[model samples]
Target: EGSEGFSDLPCERYHLPRPMGRLGKFILPNLLLPRALSDRIGAELLHVVTPYGCAFPTLPVPQVVTIHDLSPLTFPQGSSWMQRAHFHRLLPLILRRSRAIVTHTTRVAEALSRRFPGIGGRVHVIPPGIPSLPIPAGAVPAGRPFALHVGTTEPRKGLEILLDAFREFPLDLYLVGEILDRAELEREIERRGLGGRVRLLGFLPDAQLARLYRAATFLVVASRCEGFGFPPLEAMRAGLPVVASPASAALREVLGPAVLWAPGSDAAALQEGMRRMLQSRETREHFIAAGKAWADRYGWERFCDRIERLYHAVVSGPPRGQGSSAPMRLSQRPDAPQKETPRKREIGTA
Candidate 1:
C-alpha cells in the first residue's frame, strides 16, 4: 500500500497507455510490452515494483526489482494459480537478472535467499514509511465503538479467524478495505451469525479511514501471515492501540513490545488477546504511548533518503560485464547548483 516514498518526490513518472479493464492490469504490461521500451524511455535502471516482470531476454540497463512477499510460493491459499506459477517459475529468472532486489522486511529477504541461494548478496531490506494521512474533519462514523480491521479480503489476512474472535467481543468489528471476495466473506459472516455485529465498510476514502482509525477502541490484526503488517503499524501511527497475531516474522521483528501479541494464531488466542485489550485500561494506555514512539521512528524523510541512496548506488554501479572503473552516468549526478541538468527517473509498473 506504501509507494516506496515516490509520491510527490522529485522523480518523473512514465505513463505508457495501458489497456482498459481489470484483466488488462497484468496482461498488456507484462505480455505485449518489451524491455526495449526502457531504452526508448532512457531508463538508467528499471525498477519493477512487483516480481512478475520480464527479466529473461535482459533489459538494456540494470534492473532493480522489489518483491513484497513470497506468499504465492509459501502460502498458496492467499494467491491465485497465475500468481503461484509466476512466482515459482519466473521469479527465479527475475532475481537472477536483477542487479539489486528490494524488500520491506528481512524475513522476505531471507525467504528469497533460500529460494534462490546465491542471490543473497543483491537483496536489500528497506522498511517503508507509514503515510501521514490527512486529519479527518468529521466525527467518527456513528454507532457502537469498533475494533478496527484494515486490509484487503485476502484469505491470508485471517479475516475468518478474526470472525471467530469477533463473535465474543462486545464491540462492533469494523472492517475497512476493498472487498476482493464479497460473496465468500458475506456468506461466512452470515453463517457465523455475525451479520449484525460485523460490518464491512468496503473501500472508504482516506479521510473516512482516518476518522475510523482515530476513533476506534482498538485495532485487531488476525492475519495468518503478513509480508509486512501495515494495518498494525498504521494503527500505531494513527494513535490507536493494537492487538495483533504473531503470524509474521516481519511483524514480530518490527513491532516487538509495541503491540499486544496473541499467544498463537488460533481463534482462541486471538479472542484472549482481544479480551485483555478490551477489558484493561492500562494495557491500552501503555501501547498507545509505546506505539507512537515506535511509529515515529519510520518517518518519510528517512525512508526517502534510504531509497534514493539505493537508487543512486544501483544506477552508478558498472554494467554487469564491465569493470568497476566505468564512468558514472547522469543519474548519479549529485543534486547541486543550477548549472547541471536535473536527474529524473521514469516509473512504470510491469
Candidate 2:
C-alpha cells in the first residue's frame, strides 16, 4: 500500500473536509469508513492522520495532529465564522487527545505552547520540506522585471501594501494565486489606475510556477502572519531573492537575515523598501546568495527523516540520552519585540 502510487503522484491531493458543497459534505463521511477499513486491513491506518480542527471518530489507536498555523485564531476576520468556530471549539479537544503535536516552525511551536501550556513539552517543530522541481535553464529576460506574490488574496496577506509599493516602481507585478476578493481587488486596481502594470496569473501549474519563479526578479511576502512562509523558501530554491515583512515569526526563523524586512501594513515603508531593493545590486546579490543557502537546509529527505524519527519516538520513546530540540540561541535585536504586531491591514499595496 505504501508503494502503490510511487510513479504517479496526483497533482492536487487535498485531504477530506475540504471546502465543497452540500453533496460533498454528505458523501465524504460515508467514504471514510470504507477507506479507513481498507487502510486498517493493509496495516497502513497508522499513517492516516487528521489536522487539529476536525472531528474524528472514537478509536483505540493513537493519533497525531499537525497544526499548520493559528491564523484563524489570531486573525479571525480572515476566516469564515464556521471555520473560526471549529478551530476555537474543536482544536483544544483534538490537542488534548493527540499522542503528539507537529508544527512547521518554531514560531508556531512557541505560539502553541503559550496558548495551550499543557502540551508544551510534547509539541515538535518539524518544518515543511520543499520538493525540488526541474529548473528551466536560461538567462532571465531583462526589461521585464517583476516581483512575484504567492498566496490567496486576503486582508492578512498584506496584498494591499504590496500593490501600493509596485505602483511606485517602474517594474511590473505578478500575482500568482487565487484572489478571494476578486471584485474588491479589481476595483482597487482600477481605482489606482494600475491595470497595465499589474497582472493576475491565477493558480499556475507547478511547472509554470517554477518558470515564474525563475523569471521573477524577486519574491515579495507581505503576509501579516504565517505558521511557515512556503513561498520564500520556494523562491530561494529558484535562486530568487525575497523581500518580506517581519510580521511572521516563521519567516524570521527560516529566512533570518537573508530576506529584506519591511513593516506589515505600512505602505510608505513597503514602497521605500521595494524601491531600495530594485535599485541596489549589492543588496539583491546578498539576498540571492543567502536565500539559496537557507533553502538548502530544508529538503524533503531531511524532513521525512525527522518525521520518521518523531514517529518512532512517539510509538516507542525518545532515543536514549537525547534531550529536547528547542533552540538555545535567542534574538538579541532590540527591535524584535516591536515587530510582533498582531494583525493590521496595509491598503493600496500588494
Candidate 3:
C-alpha cells in the first residue's frame, strides 16, 4: 500500500499494509523497492503526494501531488541541494498530470495559480485539523505568562531572529520541539546571554503540550515559510493568542486577523510586536476570542468531507471551478496591512 522514504514510510509500512492484507489484498512486489527504482517501476501506479513541488519520473497513473508551499522555489537559500534537485526534476510532470493538487492554505493556492497559471481551479485547500482535546473550564492559568515557540531547529524557522527580539521582552521564552542544531543554537544563546531566560524544551507528549498551552500566555511563530503552521492553530484551539511572522502565508491564512504579525529577520519589529502583545490586555482578549472562533471553523469532519469530494472528483473527472462551493469557510476578518503558545519548561538536547 505504501513505500519507504522518510516521514510517511513507517506509518505506511506498519499500519497500511496490514489492513489491506486482512481484507484479502496484497501489495504487489513484496520486496521493498529503493526510491529511485520504485519511481521507475511504479511509475504507472504512482500517485505522488508531497509538500515540495517537483516532478518525478514519468508516471502512468494520476499523480495527486500536494504542494505544501513553494518555499524551495521561492526561497532557495534555505533549501538543501537534494530537495532543490528533487523539486526541479519532478515539479513539471507532477503539475502536468496531477489529478487534484492539494494545498494546506488559500495563500498557497493563490501562489500556485500565479506561478503556474490555469491550475488555480484544480488546487484544493485542505487545512490540517487538530484532534479534539478535552477543555476544562477555568483551566487557564491566572497570571503565569510565557511565550511559546514550536518547530524543529532550522534557520528558516527564524529562531535566531526570535531570540534577538525576545531579549527585549521580560517574559520567559519556552521553545517546544526537537533541537536539530544543538551546538549552533546553544552558541547563539550563549553569545546573546539568554541562558536563564530562553529555554528549549524538546518534543513533549500531547497531554503535556495541552497542559503547557493552558498555562501559557501566548504562542509565537517566526517561520520564514510554512505550508500549514499547525502550532498556532493548536494554540488557538487552546484559547491562546498568536504572535507570528508575516513571511508565512499559511500562518496568515489560518490565523487571519487574529494574529500579531512581525516582519521576519527584523529584530526591532519583532520586539515591538512582542511589547504590544504583552502590554495590551484588550488586544490579547480580542485575539483570544477571534482565534477560538477561527479555530472552530476548521472542523475535521468538514475537512474530510472536502477531501473525499476532491478524491472522487480527481478519480472521476477534473475539479469544479474555484468559486464552486468554497471548500473552506473563509475567515471573515477584514484584510488589514500584514502581519501577524504555551506550554511547559522542559529542555532536551539532541
Candidate 4:
C-alpha cells in the first residue's frame, strides 16, 4: 500500500532491482548503482525521490527522502541492532543533505524536525491516502461479536497488551497479520487461556480482509506508536467503530475524537472502550459516522495532489548551496520512478 498512493499520479515509475541485506542497504544503492546506471537516461534529473529515508547514492541531483517512522529508535527491541546502528550512522547525513523530507504523520515530522534541527521547513507531513473500497457482496462472518486487530505481531504494535485486555473479555478477538513472534504470541495466548477465543487469520488478501472488517463488531488498535495508523482509517472506511490506544500519537492525531480511545496499556481501559462500543448504540453510531467522515477526506486524489505539488515545488525551486550540482531546469530533466512489489509488503501505508 505504500506505493498505492502514487498509482494515480502523473509520473513514470522505474522498478529497479536492489541487492540483499547489508550490501543493498550500505553498498549497492549508495555506491555502485548510481555510477553504473544513472547516466543511462539521456536528460538531466530535477530531483531523485527516495521513498526510504536514506539515499542510495551520492547523486548530484536534488533529493527528496521520506522517513516513515523512528520505530528503530523508539522500540529498539523490534529490530536488529545492526539495522539500528545503520540508521544511527546514516540518518543524520540523510536529513542534512536531502532537499525535502516527507513523513506520513505530522507527529513524526515534528519529531524528526526536533531531532534534526534547522530542517523544520523541509519536513512535509503528507498523510497516506486510502482508496475507496466497494463493499464485497457477501454475508458478514457469522459468529459471536468480535473485535479485530489487523497488523503484524510486533512488540511495537502492542499485541501483548491487547491479549492481556482480552483475557477477561467475553467477546472473541480476531488478529489478521503474519506473526513474526509466533512462539512468543502463542505462549502468551496459552498462558492467558485465550486460545479458543482469539483467532489468527494470518495474512489475508484484500477481499478476505474487507469481509472480515465488515463482519467485525468493531476494530481495536492497540499500537504503541506508528508513522501513520492505517488500520483505523481502514476500519473507518469500512464503517467500523474504532477502539484505539491513547499511546499511538499518530492515531490520536489522525483519527481525532472519532475513535473510542482507551488509555495507556491498561487492560481495563481496553475492556471499557470495547464495552462502550458494544453496549452503547449511540456511541457506536457516532464513531462509525465520524470515522467514515474522517477517513473519506484522506482519499487517493488528495494524497496524489499533495505529492505532485511537492514534486513541482522541488523541481521548480532554486538549487541548494553553491557546491551542490542539482539540475537547473525542470523541462531538461527526465523522470525515473521505482516501485516494489506489494505482495507481502506490510509496513507503511499498508
Best by lDDT: 1
* TM-score (C-alpha, index-matched) for candidate 3: 0.72
Q: Deviation in angstroms for 291 in model 4?
A: 0.9
Model 2 residue runs over 4 Å out of place are 1-57, 137-143, 263-265, 317-350
Residues 219-290 of candidate 4: C-alpha lDDT, one tens digit per residue: 998888788888789889899999988987876888888889975557778888888888999999999999
Model 2 / residue 283 / CA error / Å? 1.2
Least well predicted 10-residue stretch by lDDT in candidate 1: 321-330
Worst window of 10 by summed lDDT in candidate 2: 341-350
**Full ranking by TM-score:** 1, 4, 2, 3
Off by over 4 Å in 1: 1-8, 19-39, 320-338, 348-350
The candidate with the higher TM-score, 1 or 4, is 1
Please give the distance, in angstroms, between residue 175's alpha carbon in candidate 1 and its true position after superposition.
Answer: 1.1
Distance from true location, Cα of 256 in model 2, Å: 0.8
TM-score of 1: 0.88
lDDT of 1 by residue, 161-214 (tens): 999887767888889997897888889998988998888899887788888889
lDDT of 2 at 284: 88
Report lDDT (Cα) of residue 267, candidate 2: 74
